[model samples]
Every structure is written in structure tokens, then in C-alpha cells.
Target: MRKEEKPKIDARLLELLACPLTKGPLVWDEEKSELYSRLAKLAYPVRDGIPVMLPSEARTVDPDAEPARSARSRRE
Candidate 1:
């Protein structure tokens, strides 16, 4: 028998996790389907349903226009 690997965050967990930068509520962008921090103006990609909270793993939003690629990408 094999045990199923569960997601790092479940529905309840999602309710608890907030934006590290803003300390404000985050919304799940169903379109990009990524966890977005509006206050932080960053979008953290959820890989395999696991949100990478690291700032390095995040993409920044251009306050002027639209969301742009993060200037600082995740270092190895």
C-alpha cells in the first residue's frame, strides 16, 4: 500500500497564510491561479499546489502598468 502525498496547504491552511511583505490578506488568482499579494504587489507562484513564500520566488507587479517579471529571481 502507498500513502498519498498531501498538499502542503489545504483549504484551511490557505485561509491562514498571508502576504509576508504586506501582512495583509492575499487573494488566489484563479486566472494565473497564483497566490497574489496585492499590497506587496507580488505574485507568488504555487507549484504543485504548494505556495513558495520566499520573496526570491516571487514575481513583482509594475505599479505603473501591469505585472512584470521579477527583477530578482530565485537564486539557485
Candidate 2:
């Protein structure tokens, strides 16, 4: 059988979560499967249905333009 897709994050938990460093809002990014903390400039990854919220585990992000949509979008 094919592997099942990861489950979506629970709405309650998503609403309660915020950026650990900045204590700012966390935006759920479905396309890249990440939780973006715009103020902190970090993108926490969602792996195996769980959000990895640690700052050390977060990837750097660009606020002006999302890297996920930048390249292809700019070309068009």
C-alpha cells in the first residue's frame, strides 16, 4: 500500500501556538508544510504530524518574499 499522508495539525493547538522567541503569531503555511513566525524570521517544520517548534530546529526565513514561492513565481 502507498504511504498515507501526514495528518493536518489540530486547530486548537495551532491557535495556541506562537513564536517562542518573539511571542508573535505563527502562520500555518500549508504549501511548504511549515509554521512561519514572521517576527522571529523562522519557519518551524512539521514532521510526521507534529510541529517542531524549537528555535534550533527552525529554518531561517525571508519576510519580504517566501522562499517556497519565490523562484517559480518570479519566473512567471
Candidate 3:
């Protein structure tokens, strides 16, 4: 028996994706399997490698928080 591998979001797709609300760039958090929009202060989920870009689907994030700030810094 073989183990199933989890799907991963494509790099090109990430580059093209943006926050639906602020239209700002997003940072990918591989550990959390979510895309963070610092400008919008939201974390959009990535289910089965498909990103749910809808603002309603995203969870509110604290931009000043350590984790959120770390994710943003990693991108820069």
C-alpha cells in the first residue's frame, strides 16, 4: 500500500493570487496551509491545494501579531 501525498498550491498560482477585498498581495504559509493578506488582515484557507480567495471564507487576522508579522517578514 502506498501513502497518499497532500496536494500543494502551485507557485505560479500564488503569484497571481491577491486579496479579494484589498486587492493586495498575499503571503503563503505552508505550515498553516493558508494565505495571509497583511493589508486586509485576513488569512485565506487553502483546501486541497485550492485557495478560497473569498473574503467571507477568510478568517480575520491580527497584523500586529507575531505569527502574522513573521509571515510578512519572510516574504520581504
Candidate 4:
């Protein structure tokens, strides 16, 4: 049996998306299935490839804690 793959948000859509509050860029976190807004200090959940952009639905995040991928990329 073939393993089912998790649905992912389109790259183009991600590029076009921004934080509703700050209108700042968002970073995709595949593992957590969330979009992090650094400027807003929020982590928006992505469900079944659809991003939940509503501020009420978003979870607050620590401003000092960087996403794993972002931290790794910064090392290179």
C-alpha cells in the first residue's frame, strides 16, 4: 500500500499570503502545519492545505522563538 501524503499549501499561495494584522510576510511551518507571522507573533493554523488566516483562530507565539527551519537556514 502506498503511504498517503499530507496535503500542502501551494507555494504561490504562500507567497501571496500575509499577516492580516501587520500585513507582514508569513513563514510556513510544515511540521506543525502552521504559518508563523513574525511581526504579529502569531502562528496561524493550516488545515488540510487551507490556511486559517483569521486572527481569532490564530495562536499567540513567542517572539523570541524562531521556527526550526528558519533557524537552520540562518546557519548556512
Candidate lDDT scores, in order, read 0.64, 0.72, 0.73, 0.77
Per-residue lDDT of model 1, residues 9-72, tens digit only: 3556667888888777666654464666767888888777688888889999766744333322
Backbone clashes per model, in order?
Answer: 0, 0, 0, 0
- Give the local distance difference test score of model 3: 0.73
List residue ranges in candidate 3 displaced over 4 A: 1-7, 66-76
Return the top candidate by TM-score.
4
Q: How far is 12's C-alpha from truth in model 2 (Å)?
A: 1.0
lDDT of 2 at 67: 43
Candidates sorted by TM-score, best first = 4, 3, 2, 1
Query: Which structure is stronger by lDDT: 2 or 4?
Result: 4
User: What are the per-residue Cα lDDT tens digits for candidate 3 across 7-54?
Assistant: 556777877888898888788877677888888888999888788988
Write the residue-wise lDDT of candidate 4 on 1-76 in tens digits. Answer: 2336555667778778889999888887776778888878899998777889999999998877757554311111
Ranked by lDDT, the better of candidates 3 and 4 is 4
Candidate 2 per-residue lDDT, tens place, 16-56, comes to 88889998867777667788876788999988768898999
Instruction: Count steric clashes of candidate 3.
Output: 0
Candidate 1 regions off by >4 Å? 1-10, 63-76
**TM-score for each of the candidates:** 0.64, 0.74, 0.75, 0.79
